[model samples]
Target: MPRNDAPDDQAPVASSPPTRLALIVRGGWEGHHPVAATELFLPVLRESGFEIRIEESPDVYADAGVMRDVDLVVQCMTMSEISREAVFGLRDAVAAGTGLAGWHGGIADSYRGSSDYLQLVGGQFATHPSRAPEDRPGDERDNFLPYRVEISEAGREHPITAGVGDFELTTEQYWVLHDDLIDVLATTTHPVQPYHPWHRPIVSPAVWTRHWGEGRIFVATPGHTPEVLEQAPVRTIIERGLLWAARTPSE
Candidate 1:
């Protein structure tokens, strides 16, 4: 018969798992407001049990020891240069399973001079067409235009974008030049306006992902400012993207 009393020797209590490490490498063009933009997501990162390490330079990417244990990298540096050593170190870290994710020019338009870096990111920001002279407002509004981000069939099934319907934004719509290696999740089309030179509507990838070796990468062409990043749908997508891109136990 089973005894009512508990056994003298008890099973060991399972301890909570350790928190993952997330490295936030941000700095470069102040226009992107990297600090504010990245800070908006700190709570999301912390709530997910991430031990955050913030850095203002890409040089941190060159630190092999640090990169080795990093589970994720959130980069926001735009229009800056990264050294060869740093590029290789970053590349190696991701290829070895460290996730990398960023938005707008922070990832797509960064390091214009580093082909290796471009190859790793799989895209480059060509330009965001501004209003014609007659319509120019002589301010940030000059480049701000309303556009729709349409979700692809794959995005509807992907964890990062699932349930997030197509949204509209009155912001800079990046024209990214990318190759076939990327998995496009969303796209934006620039319509031919009477003031613009383009003859027809042009569609560009607005959000995408790439698989590099054992790692994963995510990019969203929105988030031009902190306010934009704060939008419900954009914030939701970004938060999910960050977690989805993190290094998994098996990876």
Candidate 2:
């Protein structure tokens, strides 16, 4: 973990202004509300010294020159498609060590029709434990309802949740299914509701991360609704996750 004189692996050292971040956002699977999601994070990112360059469409991938300066990519796209050239441009940028971080469908559920894309990011949202018939409306109790989150022993100490405590949310708890092993950050076990047919117990991951070549990757499942983003714990988890994913491992 030796320190580098430069900010990025290939870029020259800069002693003046902080690093600039290019946020690539597109409307994908309108369910996630791309505009709302991306906008929710702008002020926070700017406060952290990020220089934001926004693109309303994923078509920005068509231009490689624009991709070169981005140190980190905040993807808000949902299920959608971009040209093969665009995909390659993004993949190449991250592979070269530019950080790629995103949550929900923007990074994982995106390109559902393209297995190649899913394979690259790792993990997908297969189901929501509390959304079944009996669990309908989920923790519909209220917006601030408290719930318990179980931390993954494997990633308990990662930067994303290092000092963060176990938490709860009123949002629909997500149950993720993936063959790729992830460094799960936190989880919430669902106690079978009286109406839930299955007697077996269930566990759901709320936040997690996967490794991809030179880039650090992250995934969080609690963002099913817009209000979820406003929750203190949820917002904190996403902010750190993005920074954790984009940072290069030191020598």
Candidate 3:
């Protein structure tokens, strides 16, 4: 449920040009294609002038020195356990001004066991309706249905959502439990279906941003598969989100 409106203000302006450092820590469920998904954005980030580093282990989160100098963290882990030391290191880094950004379950559904990590992310995946009839007991067909993602009023005004508009996507529409503090940028409604619990349409945030201490957090939920991410608008949103989180100066 979305609880707040977009702030009535101009988008942030970076004070100066700086060589941003980004850490992409990826690994967990292969179903989400953690490696490929992360790689999809590598070129864009590189062309944007970011000094990129890739790591497969969550242990990187435990290193305070490494996290301290990083400007952005792109996480792709899903449903994995993180150590107390690592979790704290990540929390402290973000709180101290390092930005965090991710798509789908990479950031949202990760570490179901870590409440502190979820608190910083502002949301968690509840369920993604199954498309296979066998997976959906008593249902006749798959739940994968075409849906239109409507850009929120705030999204129209935000730099991260520049040139983005309502778009159609046929994929698993995620149901998420989210915090009220997040600024919703875009959303979609669940149509009444055989497997749905609600009789009426239910709205969910498709993209959002939130603040954690001195840091920023950005999330976009449509990238379940590479095809979805390949969509022009989706790619644009993610690129802009990464830049926004990193606080990079716009030319």
**Which candidate tops lDDT?**
1
- Evaluation by lDDT, superior candidate among 2 and 3: 3
Q: Alpha carbon lDDT of residue 107, candidate 1?
A: 89
| Residue-level lDDT tens digits of model 1 in 183-241 | 99999998888877789998899989999999999999998999889998889988998
lDDT of 3: 0.85
What residue pairs clash in candidate 3, if any at all? none
Taken over the whole model, the C-alpha lDDT of each candidate is 0.92, 0.70, 0.85
On lDDT, the stronger of 1 and 3 is 1
Off by over 4 Å in 3: 1-18, 131-143, 247-251
Evaluate model 3: give its TM-score. Answer: 0.86
What's the ranking of the predictions by TM-score, best on top?
1, 3, 2
**Steric clash pairs (candidate 2):** 1-251, 2-251
Whole-model lDDT, candidate 2? 0.70
Native RMSD of candidate 3 (Å): 11.1
